[model samples]
Target chain A: MRSINAADITEAVANLFKQANYNLGADVLAALKKARKTEESPAGRDALDAILENTRIPAKENIPLCQDCGTAVVFLEVGQAVLIVKGDVSKAVNDGVQQAYKEGYLRKSMVIHPFSTRTNTGDNTPAVIHTTIVPGNKVKITVLPKGGGAENMAKLGMLLPVAGRQGVIDFVVKAVEQAWSNPCPPVIVGVGIGGTAEKAMEMAKHALIRKVGQPSPDKENAALEKDILHKVNNLGIGPMGYGGRITAFAVHVETFPAHITALPVAVNLQCHSARHRETVI
Target chain B: MIKGIILPLTEKDIKSLKTGDNVLLSGTLYVARDAAHRKMIDALDRGEPLPFDIKGQTIYYMGPSPAPPGKVIGAAGPTTSVRMDAYTPKLLAKGLKGMIGKGVRSPEVKDAVKKYKAVYFAAVGGAGALISKTIIKSKVVAYPDLGPEAVLRLEVKDFPATVINDIFGGDLYIEGKKKYSLAQ
Candidate 1:
């Protein structure tokens, strides 16, 4: 068995938080550049320019890309052959997040409660961590700082098996139309098809980490993504929802087999900031 | 090319602004979002005086990152505006004239803008670092317990924003989309 020190994981996660907040990822940057070119409205084009310029300023000056530094969402793929030594895995992740938010000067956006009290957790700890045991020895960690504006707009629905592909497209298009400029336009639409309700939602979020405009390996899913993309852009949401031809930069669909009776789908919308960073240790 | 106006401005100065007009703001503004708005509205309900006067002042719906040493603020950009929509009309009733944030507002907010002769401005969402450059100073003014959601009194200069909803009910998002939308 390959033994990985828990301290190493903690250090890696901490560094990931700091780096991700300071640097805008290449995939997201490329998508923004493409959106700038395709956006039709003058106001939409101007918004895109500001977003690009913001990324540059943050990287050059070592500041965060957005004031809502977002909740630290850690996705971990731990290989079955590896054993974590020295400490508790979950606590280690939280420790790293705490250190990063404090040291990196990012905002602490997490609250202790949702409806009541609404107390702040000062250090931005207790990250939303998801871990999966996979085949390899290396552990892959991806940090996605999900802002509230986009997170609040996420949707999930369970359709009867008979609803088919058109149902999926309709649900996604409707969700984007309803959200309009609320999630901040020129958004990325992540669609999760099949699976159970919760799994579908997770899949939709996971799909967002894929490179922009990259299609699913499955031919059917790729076609679905393309159709949904066309429908969403046609909604006239445009950049910042100010109206334009480029409402969505890309629509990424990920799918899995489900029970014969279920056709669950989930849509997780991400604003243009789309802050995500990954590391393999 | 549209001319940009200097900041530390008044309602009278911004009233002439229209949707899609580019404006460069210079001078001081405050930063407040959901938590701060709730508290401020509560105080108003209690008939207690606000920590900062609402007259001729611009409040940005932002909760900025802690500043690095030698910097005024970190990634100080606008947050989504709709979250504070419920509290905005009340604030506007008190002579709150200008607001800076992202996203669209409710019809009530648009109506309030026209009723109160206030202006709703849109800053580039996600352009925190670029926006922070314009803020010359920042300090917590109220609701410090809310952490990053605290109300901050900021001094800004030459900040860039667009008039999204003007006093005449001109909605930039609606109008802009209508102009560019293709019939499906």
Candidate 2:
């Protein structure tokens, strides 16, 4: 078995959090530039300009892209052939996040209790970690700094298998319509199809890390993305939902086989920042 | 046209505003988000004084990151406003004259804007870096245990925003959508 030091994971995750906070993804920046050119509303155009300029701040001066440094979400793709050494992988990851948020001046958004005391965890620890075992010996880590505002608007539904293409299309469109500016448009829509309820929700969120403008690998799924994109943008939710022609910058769909009777659907809304970064070790 | 506005907006100032008005706001401002709003309401219930007076004042929904040394505040921008909808009407009734944030408001909150002759402004969401440049100074006014969610009294100059809701019930989101909507 290939042994990997958990310290490497910790250090990598720490740096990822620091970078992802202020560094707007290049793909997201490109999409916004294109949107700014084609956006119909004058107000929407101005909003787009402000957004584009905000992305430049980190390069000139070190400041987060937005104040809500978001909940640290880490996805681990671990190879079955590997063994973690020196420490636990999960603890390493949390330790990395804690150091990064504290030192990098990122906001510590995690609360100790959901309902009661609601105390700050201070270090933004206990990252929402999703782990999967794959074939290779390498560990791939992806950090998505997911803002609470957009996350709160994510929706999941378990349809009776009868709620086919049209059902999904209607549901996603309505979710975007209802979420409106709250997710901070022009938003990116991530659709998870054909998985169990929780898996679908996870897939939907995972879809956001995909590069903008790239369609799903499946021909049929790509078409679904296009259809959803068209409908969502046509909702006139525009940039920052101030109303324009570009409510959604892109729609990505990830699909997996589900039980015969289940047509689980989940829509994950990502705000304009769409901050995420990945590294394989 | 981009209009310059001074803070502590009164009913007269709000009545003069309309939805979609581009404003460059200057003067004193307070920042609070979900946790701070909840705490403020709890303080109200306990009959304790608010950190700052509510009359003719404006609140911005945000919890900024820690400043990166030598700055008055860190990247600061509007958070989703509707999260504070529950506490907004109560605050408005007590003379909270204006609010600055992003996102759609609940119907009740919008109604409160009209009833109280208050105005709701939308700062550019995701433009925290640019927005923070406008903040001249900031300090924790209350609930320090809340950390970033604590109530912060901020002094700002020429902060850019758009009037999204006005005293006359003008709603920019609805109107903008209706105007550009393909189906319409």
Candidate 3:
């Protein structure tokens, strides 16, 4: 069995959070550059220019890309042959998040008793962790910091099995229309098809980690992604709703088999600040 | 080409502004978001004075990240304006003249803008770092317990924004969408 120290995991996660927030992903930057040329509205083009320029300041100044550094979301893929040494994975992950938010000066966005007192957690901790046991010996860790504006706009629909593809397209397009500029526009639409309700929601969020313009391997799913992107851009939400053709950078769809009679679909909209990073150890 | 605007926007200034006009706003504005808005409303309900005078003042719907060493403030940009809708009309009634934020506002907010002779401005969302460059000064004014959500007094120089709603019932989001929307 391959043994991995929990300290290493903690360090990796902390660095990932810092790097993800400071540096806008190259793919997202490229998409924005492309959008700047294609956006028809004068206001829309100006917004894109500001957004593209914003990408540079954070990296050069060693500051976060956005004020809303977001909730720490850690995804873990642990191989069956690997054994964690010295500490539990959950504690390590939380420690990493705390260290990163505190030392890196990222915003502490998490709050406890969310419905009631709504107290700030002081340090962004108790990361929302999703773990899966995989086949290899190495552990793959991915940090995805989800901002509240876009996350609050996430929607789920448990459609009738017969609702079919058109139903999904309509549902997703309508959701984006309703969300409008609230999700910050020029968003990445993540669609999770099939699976149970929660599973679909999780999958929807997971789909956002894919690089901009990357399509799903499944032919039908990829086609749906393309079609959804077209319909969404046609809504003319544009960059921050200044209004033009580029409402979304990409639409990513992930699917799994569902129980008969269950056609669960979830849409997780990602803001223009698509911050995420991954590491394998 | 952008118009330059000074803060403490007057009735004449509000009347001159229209939706879709890009402006470089300079001078003083207070920053507050969800938590601070709630507290301010509660203070109003108690017949208590707000920490800052509301008359002819503009409130920026933003919550800044903690500044790193040598910076006046961290990434300072506008938050979603709709979240402040619940408390806005009440604030507007108290003589608040302008608001800077991103995204669309509710019908009630638009109506309040017209009724109060106020204006709503939209900043580029997600451009926090760039926006921070415009903020020359910042300090917490109230509710220090709210951390990032605390109310802050800020001085800005040519902070970029677009007029989204105006005193004459103009709405940029509606006009922009109508201009580009292809669907019937």
Candidate 4:
């Protein structure tokens, strides 16, 4: 068995958390530049210009991209043959989160006793972690910092099995329309389909890690992404809701096998400042 | 060219603005987001005086990042306005003239804007880094314990924003969507 030190994982997670918030993914940046040129509305073009410029300032200044640094969401893929030595994996990840948020000047957004006490956790810790065991021996860690404004706009719909394709499209479009400018337009739409409710939601969020404007590899899923992209843009929520032609940067769909009776779906939107980072060990 | 906006927006300015106009707002304003808004509303319930005078003042709904060395403020951008919906009508009734943030407002907020003759402006939400350059000065005025959510007095120069809601009952969100949406 390959033994990997947990401290190294913690250090990598700490660095990744700070880095993800400080920089925009190259794919997201490239798409924003293209949107500026292609956006039909002069108003939309103006918004894109600001967003593109926003992408640059943080790198130069060494500042977090947005004020809302977001909750640390870590996805772990551990190889079955590998052993994590020296410490517990989950605890190490949380430690990394605390170190990064504290040292990097990222915001402490989590509240303790979620409903009643509502006290700040002081350090953004207890990262939302999801792990899976894979066939290989390497461990893969990805950090996706989800901002509240966009996250609050997330939705899940358990449609009737009979509802099928059109129902999925309509629900996704309706969610985007209802969300309007709330999630920050020129947003990325992530759609998860054909799983249990929670599983659908999880898949939908994971779908966001796909490169911006890239279609799903699966043929049917790709077509769905394309159709939803067309419909959502037609909503004309535009850039920042000021009435421009380009509303969403992309629509991404991810699916899982589901019970024969169920057709569950979830929609998660990310703002134009799409930030993510990944590392493999 | 960026149109200039003078702060402590007046009724005349409120009436003159329209949806979709991009203006570079300059002058003094205050900042507050969810936590501060909540506290202010609670203070109101207790019949307590507000932390600052409300009449004719524009409030920017934002909670900026921690400033790095040699910087006055960090990536400061607008937060969602809808979260502040519950406390807004009370502030509006007290003569809050303008608001700067991103995204849609509730019908209740729209009605309050119309009823109170106030205006809602939107700064590009994710463009915090670009937006911070305009913030020339910042200082906390109240609710220090709320950290970034504390009420701040800020002076900005050539700060970019668009009027999303105007006193004339124009909502850029509805009108904009309808204009480009194919189904309409």
Candidate 5:
């Protein structure tokens, strides 16, 4: 069995958080550039240009791209054959989050409670972490800084089995249309179908980790993504709601089998910043 | 397009602005999001003085990511404005004149804007990195315990943003969508 120190994981994840916040991923940058070229409205075109320019300036100067440095969401793929030495994995993750937020000067946006006594945690700790046991000895950690705008726009619906494919498509398109300029388009649409309510939401968020505009390996899912993209862009919400051809940069779909009588769908919309970083150790 | 102008802006300056106009902002603006808004509103409800003077000041709804080494701020883009609607009327009453953020405001906030003659502006939401260039300096002005949600005083220059809602009830989001809405 391969042994990995918890300290190493903590440090790596900390760096990932800082790096993700500092740099706009290449895929996201490319999409913004593409949007700038095809955007019809002069205002929309200009919005895209500013977005692209923001990416360049931040990277060169090592600054944040937006003020809503989102909640720290960590995804862990732990190898069953590997042992985490010297400390609790979860605490390590939180420690990493604390250090990164403090040292990096990132905004601490997370509050201790959702509804009651909404108090700031100060160091952005106790990250929302999800772990999966995988086949390899290597551990992979992904940190996605999820902002409130797009996260608030997320939705889930449990449908009857009869709802099927058409229902799924309608639901996703409607969600995006309802979101309009709220999620800060152009957005990356993540659709999770067939799982239970919470599971569906998880799947939708995980789906966003895929590179923007890349097709799913599943042909049926890929086709659904394309159709949803076409319909959402047709809504004409455009860039910053200024009107243009590119409202959504990509649509991603992930699915799992559900109960015999249930068909569930969840939509997770992410704004163009799409701040995420990953490391394998 | 209104050319770049520096901040510590006066009511006279932002008052002259209209919906759909492009402006490059300079000077100092305060950063406050939900947490800070709540505190400010609570203080007002208790008839206590505010942490900072609101007259002629612009508040940005953003909680930026952490900056890397040798940087003043991290990807600092605007957050949705609607979330702060509840507390806005109170702030408006205190002589606030302008706001910088993305997304729409509530009807109550809109009414406050109309009643108070304040303007709401839209900064590209996801363009954090680019916006930081305009922020030449930043310091926590209040609620330091609130961390990133703490109210911050920021000095900016040539910060790009467009007016989304003017004091006349004109909304750029509504008009822009109408101009671009595709036929069903």
Candidate 6:
């Protein structure tokens, strides 16, 4: 068995968090440039310009792209044949996040006893970690720092099985419309269809980790993604809700098989700052 | 070119502003977010004076990261304003004149703006790093233990924002959407 040190995982997690916070993904940056070219509303274009400039300032200043560094969401794909030596995986991951947030000057946004005390957790841990075992020996770690503004706008619909395609589209469009400027348009819409309710929500968030504007490889999901994107933009929430033609940078739909009785749909929106990074070891 | 407005906005300043007007603000603003707002309201509930005079002052609903060396402030941007909806009217009642934040406000906030003759401006969300450049100075004024959520006294110059709600009952979010929404 290939044994990997847990300390290395911790280091990778720390680096990923810092990198994700300090830099905007290249795909997201490219998409914003393209949106600026086509955005008809002057306000929308101006908003895009500010957003594009925001992308640059972080890299130069070594500051986070936004004040809300977000909750550290770590996705781990561990190879079944590999062994993690020297320490516990969860603690290692959390240590990395703690180190990065403290040393990198990233905001520690996580809170504990959320309902009662609403207390700040100080170091932005423990990270929301999801782990899966894969066939290969390499471990893949992806950090998606989810900001609260967009995350609070997530919605789920338990549609009737007969609701089908149009129903799914309508639900998503309405969710985005209701969200309006809150999620920080032009946003990236992540749609999860089928599966159980929680699974659908998880899939919706996972869909956001995809490259900006990249369509699903599945033919039907790809078409559905396009349709949802068109309808959401039609809502005219526009860039930062200034009202324009380009509301969403992209719509990503991820699906899983579900029980015959249920047609679950979940929508998770990502702000234009869309920050995520991945590393394989 | 965008119009530049000085802070400690007077009645004349509030009256002149309209929804969708893009303007650059140069002046001092007190920065506060969720925790600070709560503390302010609690202090008022106890009949104690606020940390600072609220008269004609603009508050920025912002959260900031720790400043790196050679920087006065780190990436500072507007947080979601609606989260502070519960405490806004109280502060408005106490003479708060303006607010800078992102996202839509509740109807109560709109009514409070009209009643109080205050204005609401939206700085581009997620543009924190760019926004930080305008923050020439920052100092924590109260609730220091709240970390980044602490209330800060800030001096800003040429801070870019768009009027989202104005004293004349004009709402840019509503008006802008109506103008561009295809279904309508």
Task: Give a tens-digit lDDT track for model 1, residues A167-223.
Answer: 889999989988888787788898998889989999999988888888889898888
lDDT of each: 0.86, 0.91, 0.92, 0.89, 0.86, 0.93
DockQ of 3: 0.80
Candidate 4 at A273: error in angstroms? 0.9
As for candidate 4, its clashing pairs are none
Docking class of 4: medium
Q: With candidate 2 superimposed using the best TM-score fit, by how many Å does residue A178's alpha carbon deviate from the native?
A: 0.9
* Candidate 4 residue runs with Cα over 4 Å from true position: none
Please write out the lDDT profile of model 4 over residues B1-184, one tens digit for every residue.
4568889787778888998888988999899997899999899899999999989999999998888889989889999999898889999998898999888888999999999999999999888888899999999999988877889999999999999999888988888877777872
Candidate 3 lDDT tens digits, A54-127: 99899678578899999899999999999999999999999999999988888898888988888899998879
lDDT for predicted candidate 5 compared with the true structure: 0.86
Error of 5 at B105 (Å): 1.1
Q: What is the C-alpha RMSD of each candidate to the true structure, in Å?
A: 1.5, 1.1, 0.8, 1.3, 2.3, 1.0
Candidate 2 lDDT by residue in tens digits, B23-113? 9999999988988899889999999988789888999999998998888888899999988999999999999988999999999999999
Which parts of model 3 are misplaced by more than 4 Å? none
- Where does candidate 6 clash, by residue pair? none
Cα misplacement distance, residue B92 of candidate 6 (Å): 0.9
Q: What is the TM-score of each candidate against the true structure?
A: 0.97, 0.98, 0.99, 0.97, 0.93, 0.99
Sorting all predicted structures by DockQ, with the top scorer first, yields: 3, 6, 2, 1, 4, 5
Worst 10 residues of 6 chain A by lDDT: A110-119
- The candidate with the higher lDDT, 4 or 6, is 6
Residue A23, model 3, lDDT: 90
User: Against the hidden true structure, what lDDT does model 4 obtain?
Assistant: 0.89
Tens digit per residue, CA lDDT, model 5, B1-184:
5656566566676677788889998888999988899999999889999899889889998876665677777767888888898899989999888899888788899888989988898999888777877788888889987766779888888888898888888888778777877764
On residues B8-122, what C-alpha lDDT tens digit does candidate 1 reach at each position? 5566676788888888887778888988999999999998998898887889999888888888888887888999999999999998988999888999999999999988998
Q: Candidate 6, residues A1-281: lDDT per residue as tens digits?
A: 89999999999999999999988888998999999999988899999999998888886787899999999998999999899999999999999999999989999887788887767889999899989899989999999999999999999999999999999999999999999999889899999999999999999999999999998999999999998888888887799999998999999999999999999999999999899999999
Candidate 5 error regions (>4 Å)? B4-16, B64-75
Error of 4 at A156 (Å): 0.6
